[model samples]
Target: MNAPRKLWLWHVPLILLSAIMLLPLWWMVVAAFDPMHALIGGHLTLWPVTWNLKNFVAAWRSQPFGRYYVNSIATTIGIVTLQILTSSLAAYALAFLTFRGKRIIWGMTLLAMMIPVQAIFIPDYLILSQLNWINTYQALILPFAASAFGIFWLHQAFRNVPRALVEAMMMDGASPLTILWQLILPNTRPAVITLAVLNTVFHYGYLFWPLLVTNTAAYRVLPLGLSYFVAQQSGFMQWNLMMAAVLMTVLPMMVLFALAQRYLRAGVMHYGIRG
Candidate 1:
């Protein structure tokens, strides 16, 4: 076959995967509009028999989702900011500095990355409880302040930075911190951006810890509030309202994903260009 035909064939799997990914979102939009009666057949659909805003109204009024939104956004910002700071500093040290126990520290970081998050939940909870941070923003934000994966990812990215450039900066009187902030990070834009995006999505969607700590709506995040919203309906619950709530929580992430994709697409770099 021709080059065009071969390229078209290569696009087939991607198109199929995209559709698979979109199917649930399509169903969600449909369910968010349809009446409760119509959704009881246990069949998934993209077509809405109704288009009333009742579900949205009910979902919003059913809980303090407004507060949940605030909590989610604040905690997400805090976690991402701290992760970037801690991960970058640790990664920078691991990449460039000659410190005592460097190899041991690197080994521990790798081990931390390899450990499952669930395994640490108990100890993490105990630490936060001892500090009396349960149900507070600190409970939500503090545990995720450092990410082993972020450190490892940035360490590898930092390693890929041209050594000659770092040496030149050093010779020109650049301090380690200065070199990290100015030279290292700028050149590794994609890696940093990817880490930020991943952390944002993960922390923003975090539910288990919020559920474990927060008992009141005052400190509730979106996911935890969503669970309460679902539980509010006793028997044959309003899936439409639940779908509405879910989509409401997901809308922020969808917007973020859209924004992030634009930058991701423009992330291609030439050899001499800063990413």
Candidate 2:
């Protein structure tokens, strides 16, 4: 077979795998539109028995999903923006600059990465509580202003950049910040996008931190909102409604992933190339 024809043939398995991976999402779509009775019938089926968009409307009206969306979007955006700034600058310093305690600081960062967020939740919560930031956007966004993982990810990408290129820019009178912004960051675009998309998805779906910090609706995020909805429907959840709410909760991340799909693969490949 010719090279192009063979390449086309290779896509068949990938297409099939993609469909397989999408099955649960497809099931959710079918369930979201299925009438409550149809969903509760306990029959195994892949298709919706009937078309009913009311599940979506009912789900929305039953909860303050719009407000939840606003809270989630605002906090997630804040966290991501601050994270990129902190990560890029810290990573640049670690990768290209020399200073006192550099190894010790890098060691600390690596140690921080090994420590899970759950392990630090109590301290984080106490810090927020002490600041009287409970239920505020500050409580939600401040703790994540600097991400250990983000710093590590960008640092790896930065190290892959040739030191000579950075020096050349410096020789021409470029400031470190200028070289970082105008040169290094552009070359590491995939890594940045990959981190942004990942961060968005995580923060958008995060339940535990928001649940711990915020008790009021004003700061409630999507996952916490969904839990409340589930609680409200505990005894007999309308499966269709549940599916609709979940779909709404995850829709943003889905769109984000779809848009950044190419960058994710490229980022992984780029990181793996030299590391």
Displacement of residue 203 (Cα, Å) in model 1 is 1.1
Global local distance difference test of model 2? 0.88
Pull out the clashing pairs in model 1. none
Compose the digit string of candidate 1's lDDT tens values, residues 140-227: 8888898888898888789999999998999999998999989999998877887788778888898888888778889999988888
Model 2, span 1-275: residue lDDT tens: 64665677878899999999999898889888887543366577687778879889989999999999999999999999999999999999999998999999899998888898899899899999999999999999999999788899999988878899999998999998999999999988998888888788888889989999999987899999999988887666687888899999988888888888899889777764533
- List per-prediction Cα lDDT, in the order shown: 0.84, 0.88
Off by over 4 Å in 2: 1-20, 37-40, 272-275
TM-score each candidate. Answer: 0.87, 0.89
Clashes of 1: 0
